[model samples]
Target: MTTTTRTIPFKADHVGSLLRPERLHKARKQFNRREIKAVDLRKVENEEIKRVVDRQIEIGLDVVTDGEFRRTWFHLDFMEHFNGIEGYVPKKGYQFADGVETERYDVRNTGKITFNSKHPFLKDFKELNEIVDGRAVAKQTIPSPNQFFNAGIQNEDIYPDIEDFAQDVIKAYQEAIQAFYDAGVRYLQLDDVYIAGLSAPDIPFNDGKYTREYLIDLALRVVNGSLENKPEDLYVTTHLCRGNYRSTWAFSGGYDIIAPTLLANEKVDGFFLEYDDERSGGFEPLKHIPKDGPKVVLGLVTSKSGELEDRDEVFRRVHEASAYVPLAQLCLSPQCGFASTHHGNELTEEEQWNKLKYVVELSKELWG
Candidate 1:
């Protein structure tokens, strides 16, 4: 079992967020309407966090998060909070597949980009660090450098050159990583969905000055850059996401297209990869992972649906992927978070818990 004594990259882990509960939804609405104060809202948030964290421990997870209960979008809330960046709704909504539309709000660098200690997540991490009973290690999740860059489109007036822009981003992430470490976060997960989306066949992104390939190359470089000089004890990993919205998906394709470059070059401790459906291609591309490279977490279980996958069948898939990477170097998780957004997947909360409980049980079956 992975514990404080064991390094992270644990046998069974889910992407950090769980579906938001009803009370949390109501509290936000209340706060938005000024029916409650921020302090009152935090009281509610803290209470729910206790309940959720206890459930995660009871579910037998070695790694736990605060369920991202305080935020709306996982990537946006964290990235937009960075110093020198400000948020606004874009001219058009982000059009995902199946015509799912979301208000296209984004960030732009209004001044020289920098890291601020008041970047709320560090405070959030400190609270979670205190909340966990120390039975299960609390892990913090942050948006990757690529996600930050993708969210904040390049402003020629602000950054004349892409490389010049990347330097600030790299420095900001380096600072953020250190801040989280200082706050007692030893296991951090960088959620980099855009990088995985870039690998898909369709290039659905807003890029007026940069090509898809150019953006992809820059994302790879910046992510690796942020990881430079990370503390040796902190286990920093990444979840390569395909869009997860209410059981819907945005990008389709395999890591094959980006594997040789992104996976081989990425210096993180491990990868949480999506392999829940045919949309994510075969495990053959996993062979490209260098022998000394980061380990892999086989995201074989689906967070998009409520139906729990069969245990034997799940193991069958793990064994199949092991043909490319050693089983010893692999772990299991959901393809993505049950709630990448506050609305979460189509499943009931009970179903979501069952899915996590299943991963814990399955990991024990395979790894113990």
Candidate 2:
């Protein structure tokens, strides 16, 4: 594998949406009631994802995500694609301390060895490459290792021991990553908001069982354990979001808590950090980042709303962050995707494309 690094001064993010149409809602309702089979729903997802990828390239996006179009929620939807994984829908629903309620049923992994019948990621990437007219990077997003750990503990019937469960989860993830690499995808991003929430005093890792240092060690092990001996040219990264659902947030804390680990220890090519507001705190903590490795993508714009970001202000923050990491080692994008899940956030599809246009415009003016 070549260790060649390319810097074309392009800007992009981790993952994107699947552009679900209103018909999906009606179809999903049918699926929920047993009126339609899961196979048909998958077909809808494929068609929508194709449109999403085409639109992204037409808008001049440097990298395109399948738009997570087929997913109900990012993490669980992907986990459900695996065998032995089932959703545990609660009667009243588990409540976020932030007062937000999630309709998603918690996910659990069964120990039985069952792989995905067909890798959706492989099919989508292949389709995207065929249809897009120009050269654009292709990416696939999966939940972080910590996400799998959390999912395993969501229900008790699947696995009695969380540690053993984590082992199984890690094995499964390693397999999934390898499969994506084999399918010709070079960029893989692990979507993780769990670390950001852990920085808060309210909810801690493993239910507050570990301190910040311990949690960092655990996070490193989980991420790096699965990453061991992979293809060198395959670039893996992580995108951190406070939370984005219907324009509502789920956590509030600065990078101060996770700076040491997030900057120095976490293994990945770049970090997609949310710096859209004060919720992300100051940039001083970024100084802890090791100078020798990984690019840092400055997430200075907001995808929560359609309002365009002040380009000047975005540039200001970018330079401020550059105080630690060099500008050449940096890139820019929204704090998170417009629709982290299939709900598509509170903004319209037009707004999403406009926001991306701003990223491209700003990146060109600043970096060019």
Candidate 3:
């Protein structure tokens, strides 16, 4: 296997979010019920974040994140902080496999979407950076601009044309990139479900208003637009997953549909792709990835379950993918974050750590 010394996209990397500890879960509930003040909740969150950060470093990870410990849902929390967006209970929750439905909470546009200069996540990263204090690379994750389209443009009156709405989103994300870069985040990840969702034949995207290809192209435009002025030193990547809620998934398909466009054109440092099972299809599409372009961090391990993956299987798959992209351009990670939401997957906290530790060990065996 090809080996190299790179810190940003480590051989053993993870998509940011980690499972929330029981105490933090309790603290959130208490704060929601008004049983404790916001300050009290913040204190609990701070303590939990520090502990998780330490655990990540202890497990031999080169990069660490806040584990998204402060939020309930991964994307909604970050989106709602943007101006002109508000959270509300949707008429129905997202339908996952086996008829499993997610929580009803979702975000919508109220007027015009703009990045809040004082976005809470800036402070969140600042606190995380202070805690890390050069011990490890502190990576920050947020939703991709394409997610807003998946959320749907609720107020068409404010944005009569879809193109206009898309432009504003691109601008908002551009500001967000700058904001985070200013806040001292050198590594950033944009968690994306929408672009990958287009590949799932199960979902009827755009409702006949646009073809799958059209939507995919539009999504790529927004993503690339957001990165237009991103600082060269700020390493940005995207994590694409089908869905993660209570150990269930919403869509099932292959990268074959979106691979040519997404893998070939999307401008980013790397792509954290979901390839845990057959649902994501074969690695043939990876051939479209440019040889010298972004590194492909293969998500060969599953995060939804507690059982460990066979080490040999993972190694075989890594080499298999190298047939399309060189082994030197490959890395390993879980298909997605252990906990994309506060509810998390079915795995226990101990199992989650074990899963990550396994990734580290596998990296050492393969690359070192």
Number of the top lDDT candidate? 3
lDDT score, candidate 1: 0.86
What's the best-to-worst order under lDDT?
A: 3, 1, 2
Best by TM-score: 3
Candidate 1 structure quality by residue, lDDT tens digits, 1-368: 33762557889898888888899999999999999999999989999988889999998888899999888888878877888787788787566679997656767778778898888888888888788857788989988888766644667688888799999999998999999999998999999878988888777554576677777788888988998878889888999998888888877989987888888888888999999999999999899877756889999999999999988889999999889888888899998998888889899999999999999999988989
User: What is the C-alpha lDDT profile of model 2 across 156-186, one tens digit per residue?
Assistant: 5656655565566677778877888877767
TM-score, every prediction: 0.95, 0.87, 0.97
Model 2 TM-score on a 0 to 1 scale? 0.87
Report lDDT per candidate. Answer: 0.86, 0.71, 0.90
Error of 3 at 112 (Å): 1.2
Worst 10 residues of 3 by lDDT: 1-10
lDDT of 3 at 256: 86
In model 1, the worst 10-residue window by lDDT is 1-10
Candidate 1: residue 2 Cα off by (Å): 9.3
Question: Which segments of model 1 are wrong by more than 4 Å?
Answer: 204-213
Q: Which is the better candidate, 1 or 2, if ranked by TM-score? A: 1
The window of 10 residues in a row where model 2 has the poorest summed lDDT is 1-10
